[model samples]
Target: MIVKKRRRPLPLTVLSTTFVLLWVLMAAFPFIWTVWGSFKVEQDFFSRDSWWFAIEGPRTIAQTGSAFTGDGYYGAWVLRDFFSSVVNTIIVTVSVVVISLTFGTLGGYALARSGYRYTFWLLMLALVFRAMPHITLVSGYLLPFFEMNIWGHLPTAIIVLVAINQPFTLWMLHSFFLSIPKDLDESAMVDGCSRFQAFRMVVIPVMWPGVITTGLFSFLLAYNDFAVTAMLLSQPNQTMVPKIASFLGTIQQEGNVMFAVAAVVSATAPLFVLVMFFQRQIVSGLTAGAVKG
Candidate 1:
C-alpha cells in the first residue's frame, strides 16, 4: 500500500481544541485547588499573606514535618464522625435509588404501554407534583412525621428522597420505554413468556441503559440533597452534605474549614467516578429516549 502524507488540520479544529482544553482547565481548577489545599494547614491554604503559601505549604511542613498531611481527612473521618455520615448517605441514596427505580420501572412501563386516557393525566399530575417546591412538600411531611415520631431518621430521609425522585424517574423511564418498539414486549409474550416475565427477562434487559441513567439521577438527588436531609435527619443521622455544612458552622473553630474541605472532596469523588463510569450509558439512554416525542 502506498502511504500519503496527512493533510494539515483545519484552523477551526485547532481553535476548538484550544477552547476545549481551556474549558477543562477552568472546570477542573477549583477541585484541583481544593484537593491540594485539603492537605495543608488552614493558614497555609487560606493565606492572606501570599498565594505561594498554598503551593509551598510552609505551615503544613512545620506542623506535620511534611509538605502534605492527612490530618483533615483523619479529623473529619474520625473525630467529626464523618464516617457515620458516609454510612447514612450510602443507606439513604441506595434506598432512594432502589425504591425509585423499582416503582419508576413498573409505573413507567405501565404508563408507556397503557392505552387508557388516564395515563396522560397521571403523568401530568406527577409533573405538577415534581414542579412544586421541595421545601413545601417537606414541610407537609413534617407534620405527619412528627406525629408518627419518625422524624430525624435515615428511613425518613430515604422516604422523602424517593418521593422527590420518583416523578423524574417515571418520566425518564417512560420516555425510554416509549422509544422501544412495543413489539419487543409482545414478542416476548408470544414466545410463551407472561407479561411480567417479558418485562423482567426481556424488556428490562433492553432498558438497562435507561434504568442505569435514571438510577444515577435518583442516586445523585439523594446523595447531594441538603435541605431535605438536613431538616429530616437529626445530628447523628445526618448525611455528608449536611455534615459538611455542620463543619462549616464550626468555622470559628481552628481547622474546621479544612474538615469541611476534606469532606467535600470525599463526597464529590464518588459522583465524578459514577459519571465517568456511566457516561456512555447516560448518553446512549438520552439519545434512545430522544427518539420518542
Candidate 2:
C-alpha cells in the first residue's frame, strides 16, 4: 500500500477559522444570553453577585415551581397584546414584498433589455434615492400623508416601504436579469410567445433564485424598520420592533424587563428560522451573478 501523508492547515486558514468562530460567538452569544435570561426574574438575571444565577434558575424555579418559566412570553404576548403587532408586521412585510417585487421585476427587466440611453440616467437616479437616508424621505411624506388623512395606517406604511424598497430592488433584480442569457427569452419569442409570455414562461422560473434573494432582503427591511414605523404608525398599528422599543421606555416604571427580553427573543426566532430554512437559496441567489457560467 502507498504511504499516506497528512497536510497541515496553512496559517492563513487557521487564522481565518479562528476569526470566524470568534465573530459567530460575538454575534450569537447575546441572543443566547437573552433567551436564557428571559426565563428568569429580573433580580436573578441581572444580579451582580454571580452570572451563573441565570443559568442556575433557582429563583425561576421558585416563582414558577419549575426550572424555567414562560411568564415573560405570556405577559408580553397575551397580556400586552403583542400578537396584534405581529399581525401588523406581517401585513406590512408581505404587502411591501409583493408590491416591491412586482414593480422591481418589471423595471429591472426593462432596464436590462432596453438599449436606450435614458436607462443609465434612470438607474443613476435610483442610486441617488437608495443612498439617501430613509428617515429624510419619511419627513417629506409626513405632511402629505397628514393632508391625505392616511397617516398611521397599514396602507400608508406599506406604500412608503414599497417606494423606499424599490430602488435597491430594481438594482438587484437588474443585475440578476443581466446574469441570465438574453437568448432564452428570444428563443421563447421565436416559438410564438409574446414578450410577456416569454418572460413568464422562460425568464421568471430562472429568475426566482435572484427574486427570492431580493424578497428576503425586502422582508428584512420591512420587518426590522423602527424609524419609519415608529414615526408613521399609530399606537394600535405598531410593529414588533417599535413595540419592543416602547417596552424600553416603560420597563423602568413597569418592572417588566423580562417581557422586553421575551419579545426580542420572539421577534428573533422567526428570522432565525427563516435564515436556517432558506440559507441555501440565499447563498445561491447572492452568488448567481458572481460567475457567468
Give the Cα lDDT of each candidate.
Answer: 0.89, 0.88
| Inter-residue clash pairs, candidate 1 | none
Error of 2 at 121 (Å): 1.3
Question: Once superposed on the true structure, which residue ranges of model 2 sit more than 4 Å away at CA?
Answer: 1-17, 285-293
Candidate 1 per-residue lDDT, tens place, 126-228, comes to 8898898888888888889999999998887887888889888888899988878999989889999998999999899998878888887888788888889
Query: Please, what are the lDDT tens digits per residue for candidate 2 over residues 49-155?
Result: 78888899777778778878888899899988899999999999999999999999989999999999999999999989999898898899899999999999989
Alpha-carbon lDDT of model 2: 0.88
Give candidate 1 misplaced runs (Cα > 4 Å): 1-15, 285-293
Deviation of model 1 at 293, angstroms: 4.3
